[model samples]
Every structure is written in structure tokens, then in C-alpha cells.
Target chain A: MYAFTYHRPDTVRQAAGLLARKDDAKIIAGGHTLLPTMKQRLASPGALVDLGGVPELKGIERKGRGLIIGAMMTHAEVAESAAVQEAIPGLAALAANIGDPHVRHRGTIGGSIANNDPAADYPAACIAMGAIIVTNKRKIPAEDFFQGMFGTALEEGEIVTKVAFGIPSRSAYAKFRNPASRYALVGVYVAKRGGEVRVAVTGAGASGVFRWTAAEEALKKRFAPKSLEGVKADPSGLNSDIHADAEYRAHLINVMARRAVEAALGK
Target chain B: MAAVSMTVNGKAVTADVEPRTLLVQFIRENLKLTGTHVGCDTSQCGACVVHVDGKAMKSCTLLAVQCNGASIVTIEGLAGADGTLHPMQAAFREHHGLQCGFCTPGMIMSAVDIVNRKGSDLDEHTIREELEGNICRCTGYHNIVRAVETGAKAMAGSAPVRQAAE
Candidate 1:
């Protein structure tokens, strides 16, 4: 790890201010991702503004028609939260399946969504559920928040405050994880809100996380595994890596989407 | 170097460390608590799993300075006060859960928190899924899972009765 100054501010405004003042400053949530990247010399920030101590960014609550998850809330918290489980069991189950117990305990949802790793599980849930990514400056729709691999629409000094997801009637996440890293090779989240169905795919895109529009259209009509049978997910822009090739990933997209629908339908 | 203080294994201690020093490094180098091992540079391996504020966490992913004033528990502190091994430690011994023991501490620590929080009614599938964070190159995870089930029963205070034989 490179030498850097560490600031532990108690409030979000103070932390954001510090981040704005320091050049090359990065916000540290659980440090599960950032620390490893720093250790590998992938990220060399001049300063680290620690958000672990920020009280404002750590909470989970049910508000109005949705659930509001604080940015600093760990995956374990989300997985174990009664509110999340009751409101959206699929989201809770998705959180429970991420990495492992230790990673779930320390890896924050904000960190996972912010990193926007194409293989991350949270982005798929966020996009499919149409959650709102609330930052210190504004609320970015999950669809617009994720730009590409390891990318997001977050601006400098803007910290993610919370994520809000409206309660869906039915939803589920299915992923074929890379056994080594437990990251999704092709993960899909299918959610049905009233008459409309939304499908989001992660880990299978060349440009990183993207929605499977064809599957979504079919699901919106039928919302069943058979509905996605003929829906051929275009592999034109899917990621091809050592773990899996583009063709295999496209196959996984179909399989995972179908399974997600099955899981959502309780089949 | 930065001045830091935290509660470790029920004792409050202070240390001066570099800003970039990882909690695992501080525990191993500064305090000489070498029970926590670093298996992988990335956070993928749970060999350095420890309990921070009563929850299992990968210490390699956290900064030493970040843990200042927080309560931390390591494998060294898991045993009973009279030097008796923890239930999980004893269960592992009985079940031969460890092959190399490199991953035992993290596996046990993570398992301890799992049963403590998730309760003893946990089935083998739940334990297996929860143990995904901790890796064991040897043993094929058969004994480790058995150890947790045995340990969970022991922790729940309703251990199976062993019948005396002639």
C-alpha cells in the first residue's frame, strides 16, 4: 500500500468536504475492494477519506413504498435485515449469496455498486429493481448510475448516501458464479412490479453491466421461464474472459434469466 | 506513524502505526498476534478472518487505524478462560476438521459468528453456503462442515448425549 493521509470524519458533509479538498482522495467504506486494489498497486490515492465512521451513511429502514439502505450498510446487514427480507426477500437472498460471510460482513453495498465490477451482484439487483442511487448531490437512477466496467456516474466528492428500491410484488436473483472469486459470471435479477417485469443482467456484458432488453420484453409479457425460451440475448457486447467465453456467457445469460424467473415465480 | 488504541481480545491496548498499515499487519507485527495469517493479497481468501464488534470480518481489508477504539477478537481469544479450547476448536479436533490448519482459524472464527448469529438450527446447506468466504485447499470441506454442525450443537447447550457402553 502506498503512503497516504487518512481522515475519519463523523459526518457525511465533513467527509465530502475533505474529499473535495484533497487531490486524488478516495472514500473508504469497508475497504474490502479498495484496500486490495491499493495493495496490488492498482489504485494509488493521495489520501483516503474513511467513511466507516460517518454516522449518516450507515442505516437501513423501510420508508413509504420502498426500502432505503444506507450506503455504508454492509452486505451482511442487508442480508440479515428483517425489513429487507420482508420487503424484498429476493434482494436479501441475493445479499446472502455474495462472496462469503466475511466479505458480506465487511463489503458495503455502496462499495460494490460504486466499483461497478461487471461481475458484482448488487448492480444487477439495483438495475432490475430500478432502485434510486441517492448521492450527496442528487439521486441517480440505477439504470443511469452504472456506466460501464468499474465505472459509475458519481462525480468527484459526491458520496453515495443511500439506495432506495420500491417494493416489488415478486423478484429473484440467479447467478452462475465463478467458483474462485464467487463473482457472477452471468447474474440476472428479475422483478415484477404490478403488470410490468424488469430484467437486468450483470457480469455478461462487454461494456460491463447492462440490461437484457429482449428478455425484459418477453418477461414483461409473460414473466415466466418459457417466455424467455425464444428470447435470444445478443452476445455482441458480452464480456469474454478466461473463466468463460462470450458464447458461454450468452448461454449463461439465458439460463440465469430463466432461473431468476423461475425463482421469482416460486417454481 | 499514527497513535491508535483499541480493545483486543477483551483488553484495551495502544499502538503507533503507519497510515497504510493493515489491521492484519498491526496484529501480527505490532502485537505479535500471528494466529491471523495472510493467505492472499486480495480479500478473496478468509485466512485472516477476525471478529470486529462481534461480527466476522476480513482483517486484511481494513486499515489498522480504521479499527482504533473498536473491539476486536482473534482466534487466540476464542478459548475458555481456564485454557480449555472453544467448542469449535474441540469439535474440529474430534472431527479432524483441519488438514494443514492454515485455514482452520478463519473457518472456525467465521463459523463461530455464523452459529452465534444464525443459531444452531442451521442445516448443512446453510453452513456450507456461509463458509464460502473461507477456503480450504485440503480436507475437501467434509470435516469442516461437520465440525460446524457439531460445534453449533455444543454452543446451543443441547449437545447430544453419549451413551455409556459396557
Candidate 2:
């Protein structure tokens, strides 16, 4: 890893100021993804603005009909948070299954979504739940926040502060994970809010996590597993790798979507 | 260079380290506590697992500077001051949980953490699931699972029982 100056800021304003001032400074929340990248020499920032010391960016609370999760809350904290569990059990489950126990203890939700790994689980939950990505600068809807694999709408010096997720009427996530890395091979998150239904797929999109509109439209008609009888995930833009071919991923997407719906319905 | 200070194994220690120095490097090189091993530099293997502020984390993945004020407990801290083994350590010895023993320190530390969070009454499935972070290359998981179960029970017995308030 390249040697870089490290700054531990006490507040979001100071952290953002450091990020804006440094030409090549990156925010370090949990440092799970960034540290590994640096270790491999894939990224070399001149400075690192550590957000671990920022008090404003740490918490999980329910606001009205949604939950406001601080950017610095670790996966373990989220998974164990009573507020998160009561508000969105699916999200809590997703947090519990990320990587392993050790990883969850240190990895934060903000880092996971900001990195925007194609196979990450949080993106699916955020998009399916219609979450709002709150940054120091502004708020971006989940649908518009994620651009593609390892990409987001975040501008330079913008730091994610919190994520607000609406309490879905019913929601559940089902994942087929890669045994080695525990990353999603093909994961699906299903959510229903009144008359609207959203189905998000991760680890299958060639570009990144995407909503399966056909499945969503079908489920909106009838919120049941049978509602997705003929709906299918098109293999055209799905990921194809040694772990799973595009066709296989497509099939798994449909299967996982059905399972997610079943789980949401307590079937 | 950054000056980092933290309590390791109940002792306060301070050192000057590079910003990129991993916590494992500080624990092993600067502090000269070599029980914590780094099997995989990447965060996959849990060989370097240690408790920071009372939670198990992979030391290799954490920068020493990040743990500047945090209290850390490594494998060397698990036993009593008089050399009494922690229940989990004793259980591993009785159950023969390790073969090569390369992963034993991490496995034991993670086991203690599991017991702390999940309670002493653990099922076989839960033990296996919780052991996801620590990988024993020997694949000696059966005995390790047994050891965790027994160790959890032993830990419960060793805890000071509180008297009921009148």
C-alpha cells in the first residue's frame, strides 16, 4: 500500500472540507474495500480522510415511516440494531449475510454502497426499498445514485452521510452467493409498498445492480410467486463469468426472485 | 509517520508507524506479540482476528492509526495472568480442535466472540455458521465445532453468578 496522510475528522463538515481541499483524498469509513484496493496497488490516493472519528455519521434511528442509518454504522451494528430489525427485517438479514462475522464487524453500510460493487447486497436492498442516499452535499434517490459497476452519481469530494429507507409493507432478500467470497452470484430483493412492487437484482447485471421491471410489473398485478409465472430475466445484459454463465444467472434471477417473494409473504 | 497509542492485552503501548501500517504489523513487529498470525493478507482468512473495543475484527484489514485510541486484545490476552487458559483454549486442547494449529488462535478468539454474542447454549449449525470468518485449512471443523460448544458451556460456568436482588 502506498503511504498517504491520514486525517481523522470529528464532524461531517470537517471531513467534507478535507475531501474538498485534498486533490486526491478519499473517504475511509470501514476501509474494507478501499484498503484491499490500496493493498493491491489499484488505487493510490494522496490523502485519506478517515470518517471513523466523525460523530455525526454514526447511528441508526427511525424517522416517521423510514429509518435513517448513519454512514459509519458497521454491518454488525446494523444487523443488531433493534430499530433496523423492527423497521426492515430484510435489510437486517442482508446485513447479517454480508461477507463473514469479522468483515461485518468492521465494514460499514456507507462504504458498501459507495463502492457499488456489482455483486454487493446493499444496492439491491437500497434500490428495492426506494432508499435515499444522503450526502453532505445533497440527497440522491437510490435509482439515480448507482450508475454502474464500481460507479455512482457521487461527485468528487461528496461523502455519503446517511441512507434513508422507507419501511416497505413487505420485503425479503434471497441470494445465491459465491462460496469463496460470499458475494452474490445472483441475488434478488423483493419489496412491496401499497400497490407498487419493486424487484431488484444484484450480481447478474453486466453494468451493475438493476431492477427487473418485467418481474416488478408482473408482481404489481398480483403480489405472489405465481404472479411471476412467465416473467423472465433477459440474459442479454446479465453478467457471464466462470462462476455462472449469463443464461444460468438469468435463470437464477427468476428463481431467486420467486424465493424472495415467497419469503416476503412468509410462504 | 504517525504516533499510535492503544492498550494491548491490558497494557498501554505507544509507537510510531507509517500511515499504511496494518494493525497486525504493529502487534507483531512493533509490540513483539507474534501470536496473531497473518495467514491471508486479504481479509478472507481470519488468522489475524483480534478484539478491538470488545469485538472481533481482522487486524490485517485495519490500519494501526485507526485503532489509535481503541483497546485491543490479541490471542496473547485470552489467558489468566497466572497462566490459566481461557475456557475456549482449554476446550480446544481437550477436543483436539487443531491439527497444524496455524488457525487455532483466530479460531479461539472468534469462538469467544461467538459465545459472547450468541450465549452459551449454542447449536451445531450456529457454531458452523458463526465460524464462517475463521477458516481452518486442516478442515478440522468437526472437532472445532465440538470444542466451541464445550467451551461455551465452560465459559458460562466460569462466569460469576449474580445473586438475586432482595
Candidate 3:
């Protein structure tokens, strides 16, 4: 890694100020992605504004009809939070299965969604559960928050403070993980609130995670595994790699969507 | 250079290191505690696992500066003051859980965390699934599973623990 000035700010406002002044500063939480990239010399930031010391961005609480999770809450905390399990078991399950125990202990939900890795699990949950991302400036809905892979609507110097998730009526996630890295080869999240159903597919989109409207429409009409009998995600813009071809991912999305529905229905 | 200070292996240490200095490097080079091995620097292999503030995390993935005020318990800290083996270490020795032993320290660190979270009453599947982060090419991981099971039980019964400075 290149030599860089390190700043450990205790508040989001202070961290934002540090970022605005530094020409090439990177906000690091958990350091799972940023540190690795720096070690590889892929990202050479002139300054690293470490957000690990910020206390305000490290909690899980209940607010109104939703659960507010501070941005620095690690994946392990999310996986083990009783409040999260009660509010959204699928999100808990998704958090539990990301990477591994060591990775979970260090990786944060904020960093995961901020990186917007195509194979990350949190983005699928965020999009499916209709989560609202609260930043230092304003709140952005999940759909608008994710622009593409490694892309977000967050402006420069805007720090994510928390994510608010409305308690869903029912939801579940199913993942086909790559055995070596444990990243999702193909993962699907299904969420139903009132009469609406939303399906989000991760690890397979070329541009990034996306909502499977076709599958959602089918499951909305009839909330059952068989309802998605012939539903298929478009393969034109899907990711195809050595792990799985675009056609295979399209097929796995259907299979995973079916399993997610079944899992959500307790079958 | 920046001054980084942390409690490692029950000792408060302060060192001046580059911002890019990894925690594993601080432990191995600065502190001269070679028990914590660095197998794969990419954080895939758990050879650099250690307890940071009571949770097992990859040391290679974190900078030493990030752990300035944290309490770190490495493999060397698990032994008794009289040099008695930790129950987990004894279990591995008794169960022959290692071949080349490249990943033992990290495996033990992770196994301790597993037991710390799930407690002593662990089933075989849970043990196997929880070892996802620590990989062992030798012994085919069968013996490691058995060792962790027995070690967890032993830990429940009577395992010597050093007082950690919170």
C-alpha cells in the first residue's frame, strides 16, 4: 500500500470535513474492501479518513415502524441482532451467510452496500425490503441509492449515517454461493408487504443488483413457489463468468426465487 | 510515521509504523510475536485470525493504526502463566488436528471465537459450518472438527483463562 495520511474521526461531520479537504481521501469502515484494494495498490488514496471511531454510526435501534441500523454496525452484529431477526429474518440470514465469520466480524453493512459489489448479499436485501439509506445530508431509497456495480447516488463527502428498514410482512433469501470465496454465484431475495411483492437478484447483473419485476409480478398475483413456475430474468444484461454463464444465472435466479418464496412461506 | 498503541498478548505496546502496516506485521515484526502466522494475505485464509476486542477477525485485513486502543489476544496469550496449554490447544494435540500445522494458530483462534459465540453445546454440523473461514488442507478437517468439539466441551468444564484488561 502507498503511504497515506490516516485520520480517525469520531463524528460523521468531522469525517466529512476531512474528506472534503483531502483531494484523494477514502472513507474506510471495517476496511474489508478498502484495505485489500490498497494492499494490492489498486487504490492509492492520499489520505484515509477512517470512520471506525465514529460512535453515532454503530448501533441498531427501533424507530417508529422501522428498524434503524447505524452504518458502522458490522455484519456479525446484524446477523446476531434479535431486533433485526424479529423485524426481518431474511436480512439476518443474509448477513449471517456473507463471506465468513472472520469477514462478518469486520465487514459492515454500510461498506458492503457502499461498494455495491455485484456478488454482495446486502444490496439484494436493501432493494427487496425497500430500505431507506440515511446519509449525512439526506435519505435515499434503496432503488435510487444503487446506481450500478460499485456505484451509488452518494455525492462526494456525503457519509452514510444509517439505513432504515420497514418491517416487512414476510421475506427470505436464497443464495447459490461460490464455494471458494463464498460470494454469491447467484442470490435472490423475496419480500412481501401488504399486497405488494418485490424480488431482487444479486451476483448476476452486469450493471449490478436489480429488481426482478417479472418474478415479483407473478408472485404478487399468487404468493407461492409455483406462481414463479415459468418466470425468467432477462439474460441480456446479466453477468457471465467462469463460475456461471449468463444463461445459467438466469436459470438460477428462477430457481433461487422459487426457493426464496418457499423459504419465506415456511415450506 | 504514526504512533500506534494497543494491548497485545496482555502487554501494552506502542510502535511507530507506516499507515499501511498491517496488524499481522505489527504483531510479527514490531512485537516479535510470530505465533500469529500469515498464510494468505488476501484474508481468504484464516492463518492471521486473532481476537480483537473479544472477536476473532483477520489481522491481515486491518491496519495496526486501526487497533490503536483495542485489546488484542493472540495465540501466545492463550497459554497459562506457567506455560500450560489452553484446552483448545491440548485438544488439537490429543486429536491430531494438524499435519503441516500452517493454519493451526488461526484455526484455534477462530474455534475459540466459535465457542465464545455459540457456547460449549455445539453440534457437528454447526462446528463444521462455523469453520468456513479457517481452511485446513491436511487431516481432511475431520480431526479438526473432533478437536474443536472436545475442546469446547473441555472449555465448558474447566479451562484456565488469563484476565483480560478491558
Best-first order by DockQ: 3, 2, 1
- lDDT, candidate 2, A170-230, per-residue tens: 9999999998888999999999999999999999999999999999999998999998987
* Poorest 10 consecutive residues by lDDT, candidate 3 chain B: B157-166
> Model 2: residues >4 Å from true position, as ranges?
B160-166
Clashing pairs in 1: A206-A239
Native-vs-model 2 lDDT?
0.93
Please provide, for model 3 over A53-86, each residue's C-alpha lDDT reduced to its tens digit, 9 standing for 90 to 100: 9999999998777999999999999999999998
Q: Write candidate 1's Cα lDDT for B84-107 as tens digits.
A: 777788889999998999998898
Candidate 3 structure quality by residue, lDDT tens digits, B1-114? 999999988889998999889999999999999999998899988999999999999999999999999999999999887787888998999999898999999999999999
Grade the docking of candidate 2. high
In angstroms, the error of model 1 at B129 is 1.8
Instruction: Output the lDDT of residue B43, model 1.
Output: 78
TM-score of 3: 0.97
lDDT, residue A262, model 3: 91
Off by over 4 Å in 1: B158-166
lDDT of each: 0.89, 0.93, 0.92
lDDT of 3 at A79: 96
